[model samples]
Target: MTLKYALPVIALVASAAVSAEEYQAFVGLNADHYRASGDSETNWKLDGTYFFDKKVTLGPLDQFEYINKVTNVSASFRREFDTNITRIGGEYFAENGLVVSAAHTRASGDYVNEVGLGYLVSNNFIVRVNAVKPEDESTDFMFSASYNHQLQGNDYVGFTAYADDEFDYFGISSKYFASLGEGRFIAAGITLDDNDGSSDWSAEADYYFSKMTSVGLTYNKADSYSLNAKHFFSQNWAVEARFASNTDDSTLKTYSLGVTGQF
Candidate 1:
C-alpha cells in the first residue's frame, strides 16, 4: 500500500487498539526532504508494530528478558531522480522465537520482492537470513547476526555483522550504552563496511536528558554529519527532528520530522 493510504489505516488501528484493556502497539509517521547539488527529493513513511503478549523486562536494566510475539508493518513512498518509488513490508515474530518477513518494492515500473527468516538464539542474540529477487534479476542471499550483553544496571553493549552473497558486501558494527543515573544515558557506536575494494566507517554518539528526551550526532568518513533530537510530550507520544549535511558538498543536506505514538 502507499504511504498516503497507509497512514490513516495506522491511525485507525492505533485508535482501536487503545480501547482494548490489554494491548501493546506503536505507530509512527516520518517525512524527509533531501537536497544535493540543486536537486531535491522527498520521502514519507508510516510504520507500526503490535505485540500479542506483554513485554517482559529484566530487573533494573530496562531490557527485554524474553521474546514476545508481534507483528510489524510499514509503507514508504519516495521520489528520487524524478522517479517515484513505493515499498510495503510486514514481519511476524512468533512466540517460539521464529520470525518471518516479506516486502515488495516498486520503482519506475521495476519491482523487487524479498523474504526473510530469523530466529532468536537467546534473549540477547538473534540471526537472520534473507533472499531478495528483483524483476529479471537473479536472487541474492544475505545473512546477519546480532548480540547484546548487559554490563550492569541499564548499561549494555552490542555487536552486529552482516553480509550478502551476490554483492561481496560485508559490514560490522558495535555500540555501547552507559547509564549516567537518574534516567540519563550516553551511547556511542562505530560501523565499518567493506564493498568491492573500498572500506568506509561511521560513528555516532547520543545523550539522553531523561527517559523521554534525547539528542544525537552521527558522522561518517565521507565528511557527512547529522544531528537529531527527540522529545516525548507524554508517556505515549513523541516528536523527533533531524538534520544532515555533507561537508564535502555544502549544498547537500537533509531534514526530517517524525511523530510516534505508543500504547
Candidate 2:
C-alpha cells in the first residue's frame, strides 16, 4: 500500500484474535466539529507490523491528534498540539495463548512518559499494563485486561479489569455481530465502566460494507455518539478516521487521521 493508507496498523480498532502472521492496517481523515477555523485542524498517524517468520512482530506507531477550539491565546482550553504521541516496540510469542510485548511511548502536553506490556490469551482474551512517569518522578503503573467469549452464533460476553487508578476501574461487556452476505459485517458492543472518576457505559458498532469501505459509531456515557469511517482503495492502501465529543468537557474533543504503507 502507499504511505497514505498505511497509518491504521497502529491505531486501536476493535480487534478479534487472529493468526500469528496475518495482520491488519488502516488510515483516514476526520472532522470532530463544524469548526469555523480555516485550518484542516487535521491530525494524522502511521502504524503497521510484520510477523517475524510468523512468530513475533516488530511493531511501531506514530500519531498526532488535532483539537479545534478557538479562544484567547492564553486560554488553557484552546486547541493546541495537546497530545502528540509516538510508540515503538516488539512482541514475543510464547506457546499457548501467551504473548509478551513491550513498548515505549512519549506524549506531549500532560500525558506522562510510559512503557508497557501486553498479553494475549488463548481464551480470546487481552490484557495490558503500562508504567507512566513524570520527567522528575518515579513510575506509576496502570493495568487493564479484557476477555470476550463467543456464545451461540454472533453473540459474545466479555469483562474488563483495571488497576492503579485509571478512568475505568472495570467493566462487563457484551457484543453482537451479523454477517450480511459476503464481505459485509455489522457489529455492536456495550460496556459499563466501574467507579465514578468520569467514565461510564459505552456502546459502539461498525458496518463494513466491503474490504475497502466501512462505517462505525460509538456512544459513551460521558458524552455524545462519535463517528468512525474507513476506506481501503486497494490491498495495499486504506484510510480511517474517528471523531468524538470530548469525554471530559473540561478537555477538548478531537479527531485523528492516519496513513500507512511499506517501503
Pick by lDDT: which candidate is best?
A: 1
| Regions of model 2 farther than 4 Å from truth | 1-21, 24-40, 53-84, 96-98, 108-123, 126-129, 151-158, 165-168, 172-175, 195-199, 241-263
lDDT of 2 by residue, 104-134 (tens): 5556643345565666654467677777777
TM-score, candidate number 2: 0.58
lDDT of 1 by residue, 102-205 (tens): 99999999999999999977778888999999999999999998888878744678888999985589999998877687657787899999998699999999
lDDT of each: 0.78, 0.51
- RMSD of each candidate relative to the true structure: 11.3, 12.7
Q: Compute the lDDT of residue 77 as modeled in candidate 2.
A: 18
Best-matching candidate per TM-score? 1
Worst 10 residues of 2 by lDDT: 64-73
lDDT score, candidate 2: 0.51
Q: At residue 111, what lDDT does model 2 achieve?
A: 38
Q: What TM-score does each of the candidates earn?
A: 0.78, 0.58
The total number of steric clashes, by the backbone 3 Å criterion, in model 1 comes to 0
